[model samples]
Target: MIAIETTGLEYTYTDGTNALSGVNFEAKEGEKVAVLGPNGSGKTTLFYHFNGLIKPTRGEVRVFGESISKNNIDKIRKRVGIVFQEPDSQLFAPTVYEDIAFGPKNLRLGSMEIKNRVTQVLHRFEIEALAQKNPSNLSGGQKKRAAIAGVVAMEPDILVLDEPTSGMDACGITGTMEILDELNDEGKTIIISTHDCDLAASWADRIYILNKGRVFKSGIPKHIFADEKLIAEAGLKQPVIVQTYREFRARGISRGEVPLSVLDFMDSVDVKVMNIRCAIAGCDVEAGDEVCLEIKNGMLIANKGSNGVTGRAVFDGKKGEDIAVRDVAGDILQHEGTITIIRVPGIIEGGSRAADLDRVRDILSKNKHQKMGAMGTSAKVLMTRLGLVCDFEFDVIQSGILAALRGFDVTILASGGMADRVAEKVKEKKLKYSCFVL
Candidate 1:
């Protein structure tokens, strides 16, 4: 079922301000969609139509394929629960429990059901401790949580939030996103409206950009961010990773796949042009040679004659830690005919942006470089830590390319992505190169 749909939606305030104009919005069941726009772009107005809070001035709003109207307003409200951007505007009770109970009470549910629903939402939001506390006196983040709890307590099929992380600190934003993810995992259709391009780039499965009270663009994060003209018209900036992609593409580099997040960019960029041999698993020990093997990136190289520093290098760019290379290279420096292998974990593209952030942080901490610059949202979480300017690339691929161009003969390359595929194709074409490790 279409959880929410708006066709030719238009709304005009009594003050004669056209809030929405010919908007056609849609969200399928169990979808996690984001509505992105700058301020005064009709995001709030569009959300109001979903729950029957406001009647459309022109077309109509539908909940589960049913048109919203006075006859079914109650049913629509029960199905679509909206949490306003400002907690103070939605939360209006002496205690958190009372505020949360307000919606169920309006539903006229049985006393036991209301009590159970209240308890569930409190526990779900981890705010049972605040049940008896006055919401008005709570912290801004706490109040935001309470406000959301009230809407969630209604047990709606669709949950709509307006700038959910809007006035939150770093920790608050993290916690809120976790809760939203949890709810989505439980099969609830989730829609969020925000002006945060960074958040939308990383979190949303699909994006809808609003401009001048209409949808300026609607598509996947990769495609939407790739359109520089649409991004500018929608009052948004391309995500940092997308910006980097444009820079790479402009320079005639092609990944054949556009990435939506920093981790995806790290994994998907065009590293083929470096022309190094494919990565292999193990190599036979050679005589009279110091082989410093680096298993960190799952790349194995056969050392024939290039013996300068013979030690393997593993740098995640973000951490600026070359300790793996330094340690093995130091040992090889003392003893000319020694071999060593080390494993280094780095950025991985997980299912969600939050997961990727955790992965990046894990890589940093595991590398024993914990003191990184603000590792929250944005490419800065990885970019700033890597200390990379435009002339420099943070990923290993670019570093290797630069090394090859600088006359350092690269022996081999390995990857779980395009590199692996390219290597197989090379083998088919009878082009001699390294094969898989395992």
Candidate 2:
């Protein structure tokens, strides 16, 4: 189902400035869509049409198959929440808590329900500490979080964010994206306009490039970034990952689909294992022999022997690397490690219990060697409150899977829908894993 669609969208300011012209766009239900463009490219103007913030000068804007108009504008606004590029534009209440409670109050929700919604958003956005602070007194990133929380408090089905991470720090950006992913998992359509090419490539399901008040190109990230001419013509730089992947392909080091992330790039590298003469004296190895491979002094060494042929694993290796090799058939070794997922629940109706934290601690103590990761806002907040640090923070799911492939035990803490996402990604990688809920 299409959540939002615009046909021949044209918006002109009162001062004779045309912000959007013949812009046709659509965002599917529960999709993560990105609108990319340089400044003054009509990205903001197009976003305003999604929620009926501004009427188009020409053409139509539809939300959930209904044309947006004054008769249904109130209902449409309730269904589609918009977070502006500038936090100050959205936040005006005396306190952050009030700012978040504004939307729900306008909906005439019960006072208790409105309070609950504001509280949930504050905690979800990790802005609970700033709830009572004046919005004008908060930092740039804090103000952004407060603004987003204000919109999310309305529980809109479609979230439209303009430059959501414009003033955020690295950690703030990661946490915000994780929260958005969690919302999307729960079937919210997430539409964001950003100048960050790398973020759009890695996070968005589809991207639309806007130029001169029109959509210059629209496609998946791989195809959008692969066209150097299009990128240059739009006055945008290719994502760093795409640039690096192109260079690797040119150097004959990588093949297959263009990589959009670090994990994809690693998967694209063509690492080949070659059979070579035994480097160790008096050592013999044959095909179809079981041998233990370990990295010693930056070299992959086969310890056991059989028929004078030592399998040389020609790939990057570091000292102290010990990956158990079960079979050496055709000089290929199979290696795998366990991945354990811990599902952290959202804030309980009353409050979370200390037993939950204890359970997590017990799991951590049992898996001392496991690389720990937390996915989504709830999981990260729980980990932080428990005084536990995560080894993988930004790309927790892919990072955990990568570590498991490298023969390292991984423990991921995920909340709500993200737990299912972690399991799905791990299953896609064909790795054995376990999940526990606390």
Each candidate: how many clashes?
Answer: 3, 1
Query: How accurate locally is residue 28 in candidate 1, as Cα lDDT from 0 to 100?
Result: 92
TM for every model, in the order presented, reads 0.65, 0.85
Model 2 quality (TM-score): 0.85
The stretch of ten residues in a row with the least summed lDDT in candidate 2 is 273-282
Model 1 residue 250 CA deviation in Å:
4.7
lDDT tens digits by residue: candidate 2, 5-101:
9999999999999999999899999999999999999999899888888899999999999999789999999999999999999999999999999
RMSD list, candidates in order:
12.8, 5.1
In terms of lDDT, the best-performing candidate is 2
The deviation in Å at residue 81 for candidate 1 is: 0.3
The Cα error of candidate 2 at residue 180, in Å, is 0.5
